[model samples]
Target chain A: MKVLATQTKSERTQAAILAAAEALFAKNGYERTTLRDIAALARIDPAMIIRYFDSKDALFARVATFDLMLPDLRTVERSAIGTTLVRHFLRVWEGERGNSGLAILLRSAASNEHAAKKLRELFKSQVMPALKYAGADAYAAERAGLVASQLLGLALCRYVLKLPPAVTMSREFIVAEVGKTIQRYVAGDE
Target chain B: MKVLATQTKSERTQAAILAAAEALFAKNGYERTTLRDIAALARIDPAMIIRYFDSKDALFARVATFDLMLPDLRTVERSAIGTTLVRHFLRVWEGERGNSGLAILLRSAASNEHAAKKLRELFKSQVMPALKYAGADAYAAERAGLVASQLLGLALCRYVLKLPPAVTMSREFIVAEVGKTIQRYVAGDE
Candidate 1:
């Protein structure tokens, strides 16, 4: 099912296109990135981009966009859920593949109306639904908002601003503290 | 003196320039704001921008920059400090006149390296030093980082992303939850 190694020429071309778009979008942002730039980066003709994705938005949706499906919180112990969430969120933010797709969407929110809409949608569908199913409840919404504010702010301070103390904080410490804080937000006084 | 009785031409010019810069930076970001736009908005010669601030960085330093100067935690009521802090943060983010500075700086973070550097400087000099002075010790560095992450993440999700729950959260509730969470981050239990 994994297509055992060698990709077809078209497949390789598509991957190359996606890779280029990701890098460009991550570095320059969504509004600043043009089809010409993606083509330039991918070494493909501009026509091929339209031929494949039809438009910039479609290409962006495929390349620089995504939903972060959180792991099921039901299976985990309630007390540990907050801490577990902290760890998981950190993993999502600082995952091995360099910058995250969510990070890109977040950065793009200020400049691109479309990106902002997508960011809102990700929260409505993927994020809140999952938390609701996890029994976080309606009262938990504000707390979740507060938690999200702090977590995303930390990501911004650490990666984007590169604030020293934030930049210096170890992942283990971050996971523990942030996990506990999120626990308090979503679950309430323990 | 309140200076409300006498609005000097220079003061009006300065105020107008700052307002224009704030809106443009918030919308288009630091890199995208043009001196011509600021001058046109202020109805001053573009030459005056160079005369007043020297450069965009200088203008930004004067206009779009601020720091969080936290009060001494040990002296304040421990239970109330968190709520107070969240409230203050909210005020800074939502302040009618000067608040957009944080938003512009945040938006410019990815594209403008100088803005990012200035933010780090502000954190180290203002936030870190204050937290350290209040009671944060050797391990305080990382703790503050975690707290910032939580706070900023929540802001980005709520304000920048406009996530539903984040968007709808009342100011009072956010302060209660976020403030308490921050307390735990800095000085409370595991």
Candidate 2:
């Protein structure tokens, strides 16, 4: 019982550190944010962060681990795939799951070379697989690039840049409009 | 003749400073780069930068003055406006004009609040007016936001992140595919 209690407390500390790091990274970006800032927010010793994550780079990697959690597109109706994907992304970015990881990655990717590399890897690993799974056979790579351009663009404008129209746009409207673009990229003929 | 020689030499110095500032800002971003670095690259005294541009903020603003140079779209056949705009942007980004100003702005905007605000203003002043001129009536603002999302996303993926597929896709292909989306945003019905 004593060991179990200690493990649970450690887990809570890890979670708190991660949460605080995500908030700071998302707000101030990677280079500007320091481990001390995270430690102060998490109410822990700065050394505790290094103990938990080894380094700032490791901690940021943990914070930026984004799983698209894309639904099995094969199961989604063919005609609805575009709308479905757009809807899923909107949820990933703004829905209950919270977008701190994505926000941190994107905000950092702009100026930090390492973060930019990680984002490129995420695009290859997560986005490419989804497109292939949905039967994008021949030009799958190109189509994935097209879809990414629209989706990432929307996220940048709405979430990061806070462009008024993109921020204020109704979720349904975005789904319909951007959905059409995604559909063309995914399923339309060249 | 003596006054003209002095004036010409000052103008040449100013142009050299601006060019060097643009290259450094595009390469190192806003925060990480220092006036010392700019001075070193421009081969001038650090105080000369202050004398010419006043401050780093002012220097960056001068470096990021991107004129989209979008032609009046009202004259083009409605179907071709999207293609024309995309083609123009391709030139602006990768063609003869060189994209240093745009690259500097976009690279900095990701992490800098001031640059982000300038991007929003550019979107409003440059992109919106072009769309309005193209007859994007009721949803002009929304359409402009959508257009900015795609174009900026393309720039981020292809230029900043250097995602392979986006970077490798042919200029004609990008114009064709992204143009269709632009057409829908600018002229298509809801």
Which sections of candidate 1 miss by over 4 Å? Answer: A1-63, A96-99, B1-34, B37-63, B67-69, B72-74, B96-98
Model 2: share of native contacts present? 0.73
Off by over 4 Å in 2: A1-34, A37-63, B1-34, B37-63
Candidate 1, A41-153: lDDT as tens digits: 99999989877765565567555656465878788898887788878777778876543556555555644555677766766666665676555455756655665676667
- Residue pairs in candidate 2 whose N, alpha carbon or C atoms collide under 3 angstroms: none
Would candidate 2 be rated incorrect, acceptable, medium or high by CAPRI criteria? medium
Every model: iRMSD: 2.1, 0.7
TM-score of each: 0.69, 0.74
**Predicted candidate 2 versus true structure: per-residue lDDT over B1-190, tens digit per residue:** 7754677766877877888888988787777789999888878889888777655765796676678898888889988988998999889988594545676677667656767888989888888888897754688888888888899899988888888999999999999999999988888753
Q: What is the TM-score of chain A alone in each candidate?
A: 0.66, 0.70
Q: Which one wins on TM-score?
A: 2
